[model samples]
Target: MGLLPLNYRRPSYVAGSPRTMSDDQISVGSGGSGGSGSANGSNPPKPTKLATVVAGIPDALGFDRIIDGGTCPPCTTRDFMNYLIYVERSAENLQFFMWYRDYVKRFNEAKTSDIALAPEWTQAMEDDAVTRIQREQADKIRKETKTPAIAIFNGTDFEKRREVPKAPGSDTNPFSSPPQTPNDRDGSSDYVSTGEQSYRAQANEAFAAAGVKAPFTIQPFRKEMDRVIATYITDGAPRQLNLSDREQKVVLHALAYTTHPSALREVNKLAESTLRRQAHPNFIRWSICNGNTARVIFARVLGGSLIVVSTAIALALTLSSLGRGYRAVAAIGWVLGIATLIAAWKGMCVVLHGMHHHHVRPWELFVSEEDADDLGKRSFDSFGSANSYEEEPWVVRYHKRNLIRKIFDREVWIQEPALRQIQDTIFLQSMLCALLIAGLLTAIFVASPKGNFF
Candidate 1:
């Protein structure tokens, strides 16, 4: 679980410089009893004794290396953009660079944790992960609420705020706020917007509202996404970062599957490693369902196939016999078939909603961002022991749903394409079975002898 699990080593502590007294200087004493001490009875100034002091002591408790563009190879701003930014640009801004660096440092440290070896994440881990995520999200929200839509500049020297000009198809500025007197903390004379509104008309309106002079114009944040992307693509043989083999593996596994072209190019530039080559997102996702759980899923699929096939045949036969039916057999078969479908694809058993020892969805296996942050906190807080999931009253072990719940919650799993495919396949099979039964019934009814019964 730790970032550099395979290669991280604790650095040796070197004691700080010991304090020492200067030997050259001595304190002069006043003439003792006036007669035997000095040629002159006047007291001389005491010899100054300067203390030898050492400054700029290195941080001993700090990590041997800071995880940032300055030290980490894979964590460079450019690489960060290539791997994480382009794929989900809106999720990050300049501030995310700091978070990413911290994440790298913590991930590297997690290798030493006993929680890493636990079969399932503990409640402490989930709490740690969730708390951090909520904090980050709140911080982001607070920041967005503070910045204005437009920043005016008087020939590059920033000027006062203004109301945005009314325009068709323009978004309302969320950053707009009432003007306020200058304060000690912020030191601003006028009202300021918190959100960054990225339109030109809004800037013009703000300027007009403030009655600013014509010489001023508004500008947006200087985006360097394309420029960085171009450089990343062009730099064919850029020097690789100095990373241990284990760090390299972890970094590559995450980067190798990114949608960004720059990331893919970097993967190509680096010498091929087995881990990198095999690091498909689906394969990584599969790991979320541990080995034992995967077997349970396969078992569901096997059992479900038989039930679904038998149900289809029984329903078809009942329909062909003109309602002189094997209703009990059909009901049992349908229930088993439905249960199997749910267990195999949804990874939730209809019979056992809140139980463990059942197949789970990939998303279910992984903790949410908030939970992950909470778990991460445990990495530092715990003294070699962590709180188990069972100890937490709030932690739910399984996804609970009836057919209706599944329908409503379908969108929850929509983002997961692999799971989506599984659902789609099961849906298609269900439809085919229904169609087969209908076709058999229609044929029997059309064949004259059943027409009299109708």
Candidate 2:
């Protein structure tokens, strides 16, 4: 989520080994190369070029494009990260990278004194300060204004109290007819309370009344760094990274003195490079394969069968007593077969294209019922029920559908413009390829001798 540190440079290392240069050779001081040079009274050590984790993967298919595009769900969304954690069993690489990104952001934003605070703690403190300020402003406005402040309450509040009960036998309803309250002024009675707003307001008031602030200290950051090291960098950790002993030792040694972003630079580079060169390509390929529903796969197999059948039919027509023109009819089968194969290869379902919708991905459908319920609830809470992208209804509907229905079900719409464009391109390409293949087959059938089957 945060930009990588500009000062960070790639480290040189071999497979399953730490950097060739010793820790003494690299400087972690704030003054950069000059600090190292001043201390040693010698030229600063130059960075070494490290070999990539994997070599066969082409540069063009690297993760940079995905990160740049900023639209691919796998690279951008939590769902993909969930896939990596639950399905792929390689979550630490992503988890470490994500944590490091945030760490870099906090480190960059922090002052010298604030550097010792954990990033999460710093973020929470900032959020609390903002919330407190906003609440104070709202309270001040309410106190200054004689009339009820409509701006303080959102639409949901108005909806809940739209119809104020008229005072019995009263000529003028103070809170209703004359719009005495903000709720009566804006008519709607659909207020749904989750109690969270009231709790937050009460907590904010209590904090303000007491003039209390969360403790800010270096201990929290040090503890957080220790936990991070234990979980990721330390050997035999619960989610220990595939780092070499030397790499782990370097990070541990650096963190011994300070919790600065520079402390974990070596480990960060290793994790990032691993994800970029190895995990990312595998994720992309897996996502493509996983994107295809059972129906799509069936269609692909059927297409291959059609190709075989079409070839046999064309051969029969050519070898039989039928006229050369009759053999050209086989072009229709060739066209259908080629088109279907193309669609299959691209993982684009032709039926889903026309419907402008797609089935929930296989990983989504296969999640545990509890996870599905949680996902649905979160989706509903964040985006509401009317949103087409809401997950709850899709999960429920997916389970309710029979095998045949599931195969045909179109749940989520192709909402992303880029993805829609890709499908459109694939469809068009398939058509052209099919047409080309059909034309060639037809030409050969018509031009060949009556007995010729080639």
Candidate 3:
């Protein structure tokens, strides 16, 4: 919500009224001075601001018809102009959405001259050029004359020779005017009149009808105007974004678990390829243990009890006959025995569970086939669907030298249901391996008391 207090506002541009007048009749120009003074007082009624005009346009003209392109034919000059105004206004409100902000930034910078509304020559731009020429002429006159000019010396000759800057469109092309392009198959060409003159004419009519002087200057916003027209031609709507099919899926499905719109808003924070690269390694061995929770807990308790019992027996032997010489070995045995108990308690298997003999049954660990399958699908869709024929560049797909760096650096994670699978599979495997090694060492110590029983 905005900080400002809310008050009621109304549209100023009333249509089909006595105030509407032709450009020749409208006296207000760029000079910011006098308005068509009202009879009631010397002060004229204030014209509507640009921001207010933008907000009120939907009420004046139906904005929905332009956005839903199929419902209407190709956009006209007025349609494109209104759409540009909408985008300019929308971009101002981008603080609330990061994805939209990024999209708008790219959309603004992208090359779009092809679809830009071909600007007709405007008297305003020419007048601006003439003003510049007049300034230059004054400078030249000052430089050329060594002495002060006599009363007979008139500057009429300099005025005739002064050069005006050409329009951006005409400067590039040799033709005096932009070449007329063929109309689209739909019979409406994409190019429309949007020069300063066109807006001045429209604004004059609207402001006159409303019985107020113009509030805003009608100036050329060439680049922004171009983007608006280009977007309408390509996307069929000014606000519509240019996202791919894969990106759309990621945006929608990646944040499905979270209820917050802010969480979903992060969908465009990274590239799709980056997400896929991170998801691939977590599914190296996708096997869901069809293990019952109770059975796994029981097995863990039984395994832990056995290791502890054995460790106790070894400690007793070391204290009685093995002597202080075996103290280090006994300490190692105790550490190993305790780690094995932890492994059993957690339903994790350190030995390769996918191997035939070492495979953990569903009853051995707390995992379900359905959960594994769903995770596998998400993993595959994220990265595994790449074409086999095209290899990723070595620079992008290369592995790190350090094991710790490899795991931490290459991974990109999102908060999702698949994270649970990562914890169960990858995390469990690592812990189980640590427990198995510890348990094996403890057993060896129990078997070899003299330290020479190789």
lDDT of each: 0.30, 0.50, 0.31
Compose the digit string of candidate 1's lDDT tens values, residues 308-393.
67656654555564544443345445555654554445343332322222233323344676874564443222111222243432
**Candidate 3 structure quality by residue, lDDT tens digits, 71-176:** 2211322222222222222221111122233333332333434223322223343344345545655776676575455312444544323322221332232432
Highest lDDT model number: 2
Q: In angstroms, how far off is 190's CA in candidate 2?
A: 34
**lDDT score of model 2?**
0.50
- Each model's RMSD to truth, in Å? 29.0, 21.4, 28.3
| Deviation (Å) of 402 in candidate 1 | 23
Off by over 4 Å in 2: 1-75, 111-220, 285-293, 366-406, 451-454
lDDT of 1 at 313: 64
Clashes of each: 31, 3, 8
CA shift of 440, model 1, Å: 6.7
* Candidate 1 TM-score, C-alpha based: 0.23
For residue 361, give model 3's deviation from the true position in Å. Answer: 13
Which residue runs does candidate 1 get wrong by more than 4 Å? 1-278, 284-323, 326-371, 374-422, 433-454
- TM-score list, all predictions: 0.23, 0.53, 0.21
